[model samples]
Target: MANFISNAFMIPNDLIDKGYMKKMKGSALPCYVLIVRNTRGWNKTTDSMSISQFVEQTGYNKDTVLKGLNTLEELGVIAKKSSKNRASEYTLTDSIIAVDFLDSEKLDSEILDSENGSGSEKLDSKMGSGVENLDKLLSKNSTHNNNIKTNTKTKGNFSEEFEIFWNAYPTCKRKSDKSGTFKTFEKYTRVISLEKLIAILNAFKMDSQWIKNDGEYIPAPSAWLNKKHWENDFWLKAAGLVEQQPQSAETPEYANPQRRHIPTMPKRFKGMNA
Candidate 1:
């Protein structure tokens, strides 16, 4: 007989077969595996990791680790239980294992046997009433399923609104942080409606400043949304309501006022009688 390490953990085949692994990209898989490994004998709902620990164990940069965690959370593979400073407590969700796994035939048989006196009384004692225990388990699973459905609907709504924001943004540069950008949009929309935000984006998209030099000065979508840059007066200059300082040779007075010496009438024209 072989003895297994108490800290060893298992990944379910159903997670991969059901495409849950595919949804977690890059370092997310390794990071999740590390978390699962740490929580092996403990209840799945109490796993935790600090940002420094994740970086040390995964050898991924802080941002990459954070993004991986966010991806897992978004996919419903994990739930963030709490956070303080740079550390966060996380837990594996039921999505990682199939509902059927919880109701395995072996467990059912044991449960059934426990109902009769022929089986170990210890099993029945530990489980209390086997049938009643099964009912509670099923009830908890039902609630988990309902919560997953609600989260899916919320994520869908966020994706739809983010698509609108992405299309209306003035520049396509730095569009990779869609998740982070969407979070900022979600926060802002609580104070201002999505329609208003889109209207403002539309107005700024046509601003001369944003269009100037092929949008060389336009902020990235994430920066623009996070900083609420649309509220700045620069957009007014874009709409041509506010005058921008002239930069052409024809406007030397405004462009370089100190350099413009008062023109003494050319010496040749000084003596001419008009």
Candidate 2:
């Protein structure tokens, strides 16, 4: 199970969607592609896994495995051995696309077994929406960079999913407290970098809320903070971070009374005390 999980689960669906697994979807082509990809890295040398062997290992029918292998070969995602006895050895055509194979499946909870509730696909879809937008704001690029590293990856070389789940800050556990100020802050901690956290905090004169507390700072209750977006924007700007203009007139980032803004520091006289 360790080898199976390691070999099968480690691959990203993003790589597959990026055309890595474009070979063929007939039969168990996807399964075979996954098997071959898991077994070999970019330096594709002559590697072979037979139909019978693949079926035995995966518990799929022999015909299904054969169909998948042939489909993969047809798509040019892999090259087969010239000789039949070698059990149809395959080679990767493109590593980048193949890398995305890990991202191919959406991982919807309904599709997975219920025991552990590895509903990662749902979690990713939810978090990714925010991360993707944030990346657009930061990078100013929208071409869809295939290898965009999340905040989790910047910290280490661990598997992306592990980093996302274990290393990254927790996001789901606190969503129930929508009125909580730390909601976004909590979400950001998981994906935001130490540098970005520092910058944003220094800009606001507030401390970054980390998953673990070293006794230096504590998260204030949500009530202590203002609900204005412009004010936050002002703080962000003070920290040298750019704020995007809110898209709708109804957004709270504006300065109008209808829309909340960050409070400005009051003016004062130098020698007013009696």
- The regions of model 1 sitting more than 4 angstroms off are 1-7, 41-44, 102-274
TM-score of 2: 0.28
lDDT per residue for candidate 2 within 123-203, as digits (tens), equals: 556455645554344255312222334532452233322222221222333323432444444544455453344444333
Residue 164 of model 1 has an lDDT of 48
Query: Where does model 2 exceed 4 Å of error?
Result: 1-16, 19-26, 41-45, 95-274
Flag clash pairs in model 1. none
* Lowest lDDT block of 10, candidate 1: 140-149
lDDT of each: 0.62, 0.44
Candidate that scores best on TM-score? 1
> What is the alpha-carbon lDDT of model 1 when measured against the actual structure?
0.62
lDDT of 2 at 49: 48
Per-residue lDDT tens digits of candidate 1, residues 74-120?
A: 88878887654323677776565533334454566766786785556
